[model samples]
Target: MYQAFYGLREMPFSLTPNTEFMVRLPGHQECLNLLLVALEQGEGFIKISGEVGTGKTLLCRALLNSLDAERFQLAYVPNPCLTPEGLRRAVARELRLVEADSLGEIALLEAINQKLIELAHAGRSCVLLIDEAQALPDDTLEALRLLTNLETERSKLLQVVLFGQPELDDVLGQERFRQLRQRITFSYRLKQLEGEQIERYLNHRLSVAGYNGPALFERAALRLLAQGTRGVPRLINIVAHKALMVGFGKGQRRIPRSFVQRALDDTEGVQGPANAQPRWPWGVAAGLVVALTLWQAPALLNWLQPWLPTVANAEQGGGDESGQ
Candidate 1:
């Protein structure tokens, strides 16, 4: 709604995982690099974990887009909560092996293996990318492990990459999953952007969204934004988007600190400094106290006059030195 006011062609702070708006911060870039390298080496099992809203899905999409179709046969399973048999069918569908859908569980496995062999002979490597894999049933996970066992004389036939939240780590650490965990040759954890990186990320998204004006967000506002969202890209996008809308609503071009605060207050999981009670700075309060004391000093002395010597005694003392 505020795009035109800000001279932006599209929403810069959209939460959608648009590859065009992707900002390759250190962590994300490293994760992508590791994935590409591991896939190139035909690693059996690769895992990537991150907190919610940390861009695991974006990274998954980025990886999918990065791979060359000529060299890789990709199968993506976005939901992994299926039973072992169900998961096999999902994998079969992703691989476009329609015949596997008609077969029994054992027959399905054999069909998938044959398909992988055929792909391998054709100079294409088969890769299964599972997102939200933490929700996968234990039996389903074991099925995945077994899928990796389908191999030729030289190397494994199917390679798998799992993208999931941190709970995935806990699930994999269980004794029942030790075998599958052992097969993970490569792993990378996605992280939220650092303070400095947040600024760059914002600018990158704005530029990608076709914004060329001067910085839309004031520096202080941006700082609060980084603090509020704790550098999580999705949260930053949410808060920033609201701030822009606030600025637009006020017919202002630049997003100010107050606007950012408003945005933070409306967003969930954003604990900005503004949420706390306001307090005066110690230095400022001290200076104010000193100024007040000086201004009221005469009045304070007049108020204490009743406890001082009378005027008659004061005059006698004044004349004592002359002794007239």
Candidate 2:
């Protein structure tokens, strides 16, 4: 609703994992680089885990777009919430094994193996990318490990990359999963964006969405946003979009901290670094947080001195208009 008024071609903060809105956050870029290198080295199992909304899926898609299609036959199974047999057929469908849906569990396994080998022989490698893999059934996960066991004398024929939440780590840490855990040759954990990174993230998204106006979020607004969302991009986007709506509804051009706080208050289940600060403490002190942190101590002291009737510059005729 606010797009045209704000000079944006689209809602920059939409929660969809649009690759076009992707920003080169350091953590994400590093994860992507490691994934490329690991896949190139023929690692059998690679894992990427992070808290909810930390961009695991976005990074997964970025990796997909980065890979050269001719050299790699890519199969994506989003949320593998299926039984072992179902999981096998899901993967087979992605790998283009049309007959897999009708095959028995054992036969499906063989077909998947043959498909991987077929791709390997054609000067191409096969990769299975599963999103939200923490939800994969125990038996299905074991099936995945079995699939990776198919290999030539040189390297494995299939490579698997799992993108999931932090619980995946917990699930894999179980003693029963020792073998599967051990086989994860490479893994990377995604971190939430830091304060400074959030500013760039917002700006990049805005720019990509065709925002040519002045800065959309004011400094204090940005600070509160960083704190309130604790730098999680999805939360940041949700809160930001709401803040813009708050601004637009009020016919305000720029977003302020109060607008962000309103957004935070209206939203629920926000693991809320977002607790609404009370009137006394926040009204009296929160506004100074940015200035205190941003200014050098000496400069801040110097700036304060001019307002104080202290001796450092008292004799320089500084405090009063009439030097009284």
Candidate 3:
């Protein structure tokens, strides 16, 4: 809504993992580099853990996009909350192997192994990525570990990467999963962006959306964003979009602290002493401005367009009209 008013070509704060908007902050870029190195080394089990909104999904998408398809056959399972048999079938579907819900566990294993062998003979690496893997049941997690056993003499034919919240570490710590946990040759903990990185992140996103302005957000506004959102990119997006609406609502030339404060209140899950503050009257003014701008921008632009030519003609003192 504030895109045109702010001179941005698109919404800069959307939650979708558009790799095009990816800003290579230090932590994220390091994680990406490590993942590539591990994959290239043919590591059998790799894991990445992060808080819920710390861009794990985005990183996962980035990894998938970066992989060379000619050398690696990719199998991605987005949801891993399934029984052992169900998990096998999910992996099978990803590999485009025949669906074998009717086959028992042993038969399913044989089929998957045979398929891996076939891929190896063709000189392709089979790689599996499982997201939200903390939800995988013990049996299913063990099944995944066993799947990694599909190997040849040259190098392990199968490689797997698991992305999940920190609960995955708790799951891996269980004695039953000790073997799988030990097999993870590479792992990284994703951290949220810090103060300066947050500023760069917002600017990068806006620039990607074709925004070229004197900086729209003031220092106080950015400080509030870092305080209230705690540097989580998702939270930053939510607060920043609302703050833009707040700025547009108030007819403010630049985003101020009040805009971000109103956004803090608007957030559903983040109300606490850290963010809670007495409502300011300018917050309401901003909303009114937003409403008025929405109601007036179209009519105002339309009324201005036709008059441009008439104004130019009048300025030129048209010979016919002036009767010179």
The best candidate by TM-score is 3
Off by over 4 Å in 3: 99-104, 271-274, 277-324
Residue 34's lDDT in candidate 1: 97
The local distance difference test score of model 2 is 0.85
lDDT of 1 by residue, 214-237 (tens): 888898998898888888889989
Between 2 and 3, whose TM-score is larger?
Answer: 3
Total backbone collisions for each predicted model: 0, 0, 4
Tens-digit lDDT track of model 3 for 240-309 = 8888887877667598887778888777545455356547545534695657768898887787998889
lDDT of each: 0.86, 0.85, 0.85
Q: How far is candidate 2 from the true structure (C-alpha RMSD, Å)?
A: 14.4
> How good is model 1 by TM-score?
0.84
In model 1, the Cα lDDT at residue 195 comes to 76
Q: Each prediction's TM-score against the native? A: 0.84, 0.83, 0.85
Q: Model 1 segments beyond 4 Å from truth? A: 272-324
Candidate 2, position 254, lDDT: 87
Best candidate, lDDT: 1
| Residue-level lDDT tens digits of model 2 in 1-324 | 678778889999998899999999888999999999998888999999999999999999999999999988999998789887887788889898889778887888888888888888898888899999999988888888888889999989989999999999888998889999999999999998988899999999999999987998999999988877888999999888878776766667788888788777666545455655433443323333443446467787777876676665665656565765
